[model samples]
Target: MQIEMKNIHKRFGANNVLTGVDFELLPGEVHALMGENGAGKSTLMNILTGLHQHDEGVIKINGEERSFSSPKQAEEGGIAFIHQELNIWPDMTVLENLFIGRERRNAFGLLKTKEMKELAREQFEKLSVLIPLEKEAGLCSVGQQQMIEIAKALMTNAEVIIMDEPTAALTEREISTLFEVIRSLSKQGVSIVYISHRMEEIFTICDRITVMRDGKTVDTKRIKETNFNEVVRKMVGRELEDRFPARNPSPGETVLEVRDFTRKGAFENISFSVKEGEIVGISGLMGAGRTEVMRAIFGLDSIDRGELYIHDQKTVIHTPNEAVRKGIGFITEDRKDEGLILDFSIRENIALPSVKSFAPKGLIDEKNEQQFVDMLIKRLTIKTESAETSAKNLSGGNQQKVVLAKWIGIGPKVLILDEPTRGVDVGAKREIYSLMNELTDRGMAIIMVSSELPEVLGMSDRILVFHEGKISGELTKEEATQEKIMTFAAGGQ
Candidate 1:
C-alpha cells in the first residue's frame, strides 16, 4: 500500500497555496510531514483525504490512479486522517464515537451494541488506551479523548493513517503509550503519515521525513540522514537561534495569591502566588489540574474553599466579567473553542473584550476601535490585510495572536496564559516569549500553564509542579530542572 502525489498543484483564485507538491509514503513506514503554519500541510492533507479537490494532480494508490469525490470515497479507498482539530463528537460515548459512521445492524435493522462495544474495547486495549467507554466523551481527560479518536480511525482498518499533531496535549507517559501503538500499527503493515510540530517526536518515531515550505516540497530524506536544526531550517527557510526567550527580572512582592483553594475533583488544595514582574510556570502530567487552578483564579471555575487576594486585599471574583473588571485576563488553551470566533474579523475578535470600555453609552466608537486594534496588530506583528480580514483566514500562529491581543487590549493587571503557543510556529513562539518579557516589565503578574517542559523552565521565574489535583513541589528559577520536576511530578501522582 503505497500512496503517491504526483506534481500536485492547487490554487484559489490568486492564491496558489500548493505548487507542484509531490510526495510518497511506503507501506509499513512512518513518514513525517514537517512545515511551518500556512505552509500547505493541511491543504495537501485535505486533498488527499477528499475534503478538497486538487486543481491539478494525479494520486496513485496501490499502483492504481484514483480520484476521491468525498471523504467517504477516500475511506472506501482505504485512507483516513486524524486532523489537528479533533473531529470527535463530545456528547457521544467512546464506543458510539468509534462506530458512528459504520454502525453494524441486524437484518431487522437493530444496531449491534454489544458487538461494537466489545470491538471498541479490544481496539483501545490493543493501543494501551485506558478510557471509560460508557462515560460521556467530553468528561474524559484530553489525553484519553485523543486515544478515543485514534480508535475511531482504526475502526476502518485503514492501511494509511494520517495523524496531525497527535501528542500536543499528551504527557510523557501518554506519548510513550501512543508510540507503542504506532509501532504496533507499523508491524501490522499500516503506512503512517505523521504530521507534528514537535521535533522530538519526529526524531523518535519517523523513519523518513518530507519537509514543505511556502507551499512546495523542499526535501525528503531518511530520518538518520538529517538533523533537527536542518529540518527546522528547511521548514521555515531560516535558522532558529532560540525557541524560548529569557526572563531576567526577579519576582517582586506577591501580586495575586490563592491560599488553600479547593475546587473539588476538577482541582484541589492549590496554594500559589504570582509576584509582580514574574512568570509562575505550572507543569504537570495531563489532567493533573494545572489548568484548573488557573481557571479557578480567573473566575472561570468557582472555588468552594480558601481565599483569593489581590495585592494583599481579599477579593471574591464570582464570574469572568468580574475577573475582567477586577483587572485579570485569561487566555484559554482551546483557542478555536473559547478564545476567538472564527467567522468574525480580526478587529472584532481583538476588540471583543474591551468593546464596552470604548463604547460610550452603547454606541461603539469605530474611530477609537480602529485606532486601538490597529496598534495591537502592528505591535504584535500580526500578519493580515487590514484589520477586517476574517480570523479564519489567518494562520494558526496569527490566530493565537488574536487571542492574546483580545486580552492585552484590556491591559489587565494579572495575565494568565494557557498553552499560549500550542500550534504556533517557531518564529511566532519566539515573538510570544519576547512579548511576555515586555508585559512582565510593565508590572503584570503572569501565570502560564504549559505542557512543554523546556518552555516551563525557560520562561518562569518560579515553577510549580502539579501532580494529581495538588501542588507537588515549588522551585525558584535557580532550582527548577527537568529531572527534578519530572521525578516529583511522576511520584507525586
Candidate 2:
C-alpha cells in the first residue's frame, strides 16, 4: 500500500489543527511522524483514517484518489490505526475485543467462536504474545493490553498500520518483542506509520521521518540522513539546549519516610525516605512493584504491613483524603483515569484539590479559583486556549502539566510522581524537570517512580532500584549509571 496525503488542511471551531501538511508512506517501509504534542501528527492521521474530514487535501492510495468515510472503511481498505489510547472494552473478554466489530459468522449467521480463537492465536503467536483468550481485558496489565491492541491490528492483515505511542506502557523486553514484530511485518511488505515522542525508538525502528511543527509539515528526510538534534530542532522550531536540566542538590532534614512497607504479591520491605529539597527516584522495569509502592504511600492502595512517617512523626493514612490532609500530593501514572476529570474544565481540575482553601465560609469563590488556576497554567507553560477548555481537549503534554498543576495547587510537603513524562515531548519534558528543580529548591520533597532510566539518572539525587518486589540496590547520582541501574533492576547482587 502507498499513501500520499498532500496539502491537508483541517479546522475545528477556529482551531487550525492541520495546515498544508504532506505525509507519505511507502510499502514495506517504516515511517516516523515526529512532533511536539498538538503538532497535528495525530490530526493528520485522523484525517487519513476517516475519523475526521480534511477541509482541503488530496489523498491518494496506490495512485488512486480515495477518501474513507469511517475507520472501518479504512481498515477494510488495508489500513489500520492503533491509537495512542488503547480502545479496549474492559468488561469484554480478550477474544471478544479482538473480533468486536468484525466477528466472523457462518452461513446461518451463527458466531464462529472456534475460528476466531484460532485466528487470534495465530496473530498472537506471530507477535510472541502469551495472553489468554478468555481473560477479561481489564485485568490485563498495560503492556499486555498494548500487545492485545497490536495483535488485534495484525489480525486485520493491514498493509499500512499507524501506531501512536505504542510503547508508552511497555517494558524493555516487551518493546524488544514489539520491535521484532514490526521488523517482521515490514519484511512481509507491510508499511507502518510510527508516531512517538521517544527519539531513540524513532531513529532505531523507522526508515524515514516526517517532522511537524505547529500543525505544519516541517520536513521529511530519510532516517539515516537525519540526527536526533536535527529532528528535535525541527519539531520544536528552536535549538533545544539540553535534554535534561542541571541538578544541584542541597540536602535537608527528612520530610517523609516509609519503613518496611509490604504489600503481599506486590512489593515488600520497601524502606525509603525523602528529605526536604530532595528528589528520590525509584527505577525499575514494568510490574516490578514500583507503582504499587507509590500507590500504597498515597493511600490509593492498602499495605498489609507498613509504617509511614511525616516529619519524623509516625502517621496512619487510611484514605487519599487523609494523605492529602497530611500534606502529601500524588500524581498517578494513569493520568487520564486517576489524575484529572476529563470532562471538566482545566480550571475545575486544577482547583479541585484546593477548593476548600478558596472557599472560607462553605461557599464557592469563583474569582480566587480562576486566579489560582490561571497562575499555575502560566507558570507551567500549559498551552491551552483558556482555563475554560476541557481537560480532554488538550494534548498529552498539556494534560500532564494539568496533572502537575493539580498536585502543585495543594501545597504539599511531599509529592509522589509516577511516570511523570511517559508520553510527553522533549520540550515539555525539560520544562517538567525544571519545574522539579524549582520545587525542590523551595523545600518540597519529591518521590518519582519512573521506567525511563535517563530521566531517573538525570533528576534524582538518589536512585533506588526495585526487582521482584524488593529494593535491590540504591545509588547516589554520582555513582549511578545505566548499566548499574539495569543490573540492580534485574535483581543483581
Q: Lowest lDDT 10-mer window, candidate 1?
A: 242-251
Write down the worst ten-residue block by lDDT for model 2: 122-131
Error of 1 at 300 (Å): 1.5
For 1-493, candidate 2 gives per-residue lDDT tens digits of 9999999999999888888999999999999998999898888998899999999989999999999999999999999999887899999999999999999999999999999999999988877888999999999988899999999999898999999999999988889999999999999999999999889899899999999999999999999998989998998889898898898879799999999999899999999999999999999888899998988888889999989999999999989999999999999888887888999999999999999999999998889898999999999999988999999999888999999999999999999999999889998898899999999999999999998888998899999999999999999999999999999989897
Q: Which candidate number has the best lDDT?
A: 2
RMSD of each: 1.7, 1.1
Instruction: State the RMSD for candidate 2.
Output: 1.1
What TM-score, computed on C-alpha atoms, does each candidate reach? 0.96, 0.98
Score residue 320 of candidate 1 by CA lDDT.
91
The per-model lDDT (C-alpha) reads 0.87, 0.93
lDDT of 1 by residue, 266-376 (tens): 777788888889999998888888888888888888888989999899999988999999899999988877899999999999999999978878999899999999999
